[model samples]
Target: MLSMREFWNIVSISLCVQAQISQQLSDTGHTWNYDDGENDWSKNYPFCGGTHQSPIDIYSNIKYDAALTPIQVVGYDSPGIDHFTLSNDGHSVKVSLPATMYISSLKHKYTAVQLHLHWGDQKRPQGSEHTFNDRRFAAELHILHYNSDKYVDSQTATAKEDGLAVLGILLEVGSFNPTFENIQKYLSQVAYKDQEVQIPAFSIRNLLPVTLNEYYRYNGSLTTPPCYPSVLWTVFRQPVKISQEQLFSLETALFSSNVGDSIPQPMVNNFRQKQERAKRELLASFKEDFTFPIAIAFILGIFVIVAIIIYIIRKRRARQQSESRKRVMYAAAQKAEGTSSIEI
Candidate 1:
């Protein structure tokens, strides 16, 4: 006994409810390479367009503030045979860390949560998210921590400014690095998306540089979507060396898609481009030595000038020696022919 208009209205309302439920169910269906398109990211996650985004290029001319204290990594060398979970989350390989690890340089203590990496492909060797003076390294590591003093948990801290403190270490290709071997050995186990494996405990302190004194600090956001601007970024001045073979393993060992996906895509170049450092000041722990680059350039210039002068002198001496030999040969022929006396 219902009219056609009323029947259609009821059907529409039911469909809307179903759609909302379906969306909520599949909210975790996001991927790094495919779904999170660079151009389309802002469409899905409006926060991708936030002002204070991360992975910025650290220029040479940075403000040196002596007040910025060196970060004290407490409990990093805790003695234990702890087991950690290493997983490939379709974007990059992430290893979960224990809550006991914390840093104590800033105003509030920040507890460790997890660590991850970002790397480039074989063709483009430089893949670090943050670059120094526009120079990129082979890879980069991010150790994520949350403010334990102000927030109850990491989840609550992630939305507020001064919530997260991320320590970034740049990786250069060189001799074998034992510090990274702990995680590198288990990469094959988590080669596919959603795959996880247990890794034996190792000292997290060894992964960082020997000295945490030199670093660049800034206020920025997360590099990924839902780009919350709550991270206090601390990038080290020195780079850690890792072998090329280890880099190859990191680049080729993971797949962006799950095992059952139609196409298997390798998870490489999972780094966000350098974002604008809008209205932000980059503070460095050490003073800028303005003469270092200039001194290097001056030494190289002197070496080049000396090399050119030596080459010119060598060429002139060789030419003179050849002429002298020709003159001696002419004199010997004249003496043998008895024509030297007639010419004199």
Candidate 2:
């Protein structure tokens, strides 16, 4: 029983909110899961595939080069105010319009618009992607970053071929992650549909396992619908352990709305269908020239900082030497003057 103006106002607001969904523009090419009779859940989602889905099973015996030494990855304390903005619904976190992103493997200089997670039953028989000596974690973290150059338009951008990179971190249950606890602490504030808690310092660095040297690499598509085939998949070989109890906490917290009062579904094996090799090379830690690319970047960033420090030290030393020389010359001049006076 509302007037036309009132209805239009509400509609306008919804559209405005929807307009902020994607923060980046990407190619139009998309991928989807070929319908399988397994789960009614993934029916129409673009990324779910029977033969080319994500969360592939990774065997350790695959040939690879020696593992690379661990390198430090710096993260921005704050991604941006708009990027992590919370939505009205408490269930989903939304990244504001225009998914800005940076890819370290492609050179650390993109901005991630947003990210989401995918999980499954209490235990998966097939195992998760990039397994740890054949071990599988309960769930995984997919952090979606868009190419800044490609994500120039917020309104019309899809995570297409021109711009997308996803960081996949495997989650095993063991001791509780303080970070997860922090996110959980804020869950009650927005745990319904699409609400989000803007978390600063939520860097990929902190989310990663202690060791980044050992991992699996491949080219894959986003596991979700509108399955963009532009992901540079980097699945860590190491599975970060989380206790069964801890795993349940995340499952319950993240998907409270998706499941119908299931007492926080146990996330035992929520991985995607394995995709075909598709002539793709699965790179393991002990396989590629791991150290060179990282070493070079590390050296470059360190060189700039170190060079400044060295220059400061050299200047200070030169100043001290100059003062010492001046003092010695003054003393000699005074001594000669005294000797001349004595002679006179």
Candidate 3:
């Protein structure tokens, strides 16, 4: 019953609002999800289409930054917080961290904010964001931090260059990881979207690899949309292990839909596909070496030499035993001939 002009005006206003969705500071109000594919995110979030994106493929195309020193963290063992807020933010399960834990290895002190995970479903187990030499892991964990020295808060830091630092740890299936269970045991509580729970505080450092010295460093953006190009990424070369059952627990426990939804969607494969590294320089804290290949070659050569030595020793023993048997037979034959001659 409305006039034509009013209908057109409403359409224009809706289009205008959609255009501004990309400019929003928080993703809380947006409808971006792993569903319908990640390519759709770039449409609404302009930064998601930017060049300096994250979750890049890490392979032989990397630089050995000899100048890059080992990673050093402060107050990780004691995060100075009693309880953490674990919430399912519709996309993934996140745990809020304390500002007291800061990383001291970078140019500025980057304080801890929150951490989250990305994983695949039971059907396809591998879902890590970053790939190493084209190899994918079972899952990925991202620990987010903001530049404390230069920025007032995490939100303010998101707009600045080199304002964020993220530690990306690749997770593989193996023995049960108790540190991971501290968070996993509480995943059921935050099973639905926007649901949250309180978890006991533990050593944040334990979540990372025991040796934090070696990693791949680069300047990239946040993997999630409004993919701000402000992160200094450190992806460890070594992967941590979680039991198969534990991995299944993660893939099956959570849902992307809110509680009481008519049709619930499982929160699985909640990872963004890797973005192009584009002309960015990737740095490694450790020196590149042929140690693995060299060690394998050395071990093979030693094995071959031992096999030849054993063959020669066995041949020599067989020859000696055959010569001794021939001598005894010949002595017995000579004795029988002598007895026949004496009888004649």
User: What are the Cα lDDT values of the candidates?
Assistant: 0.85, 0.53, 0.88
* Cα-based TM-score, every candidate: 0.78, 0.56, 0.79
lDDT of model number 1: 0.85
lDDT of 1 by residue, 1-344 (tens): 98999987775454345434434433867433534456665555555665788889999558989999888988788725478899998888999988888998888999999999999998987889999888999999999999999999997777666789999999999999997999999998998999999988888898898899999999998887667677999999999999999999998888987889898989988888999887799999998785989999999999999999999999999999999999999989878788757776
Rank order (by lDDT, best first)? 3, 1, 2
lDDT of 3 at 51: 76
Regions of candidate 2 where Cα sits further than 4 Å from its true position:
1-52, 60-72, 76-83, 86-101, 121-134, 151-159, 198-204, 254-271, 287-344
Candidate 1: RMSD over Cα atoms?
11.0
Query: For every model in order, what is the number of clashing pairs?
Result: 0, 43, 0
Candidate 3 ranges with C-alpha deviation above 4 Å: 1-21, 25-29, 294-344
Query: Candidate 3's residue-wise lDDT over 200-315, tens digit each?
Result: 99988888898998999999988887787778999998899999999999999999998999999999998888888878999898887889999999999999999999999999
Q: For candidate 2, write residues 1-344 as lDDT tens digits.
A: 98999987785454334323322211333222223233532344423343334556675345674543343343433343333454323223333323323455454335565555455454343234444544555766666666556556422334344355566787766787775554445655555554455644354445667777776766676664434455666776666655676555545555434334555423233345555565566776656455999999999999999999999999999999999999999999999999999999
Q: Which is superior by TM-score, 1 or 3?
A: 3
The alpha-carbon RMSD values of the candidates against the true structure, listed in the order shown, are 11.0, 21.7, 10.3
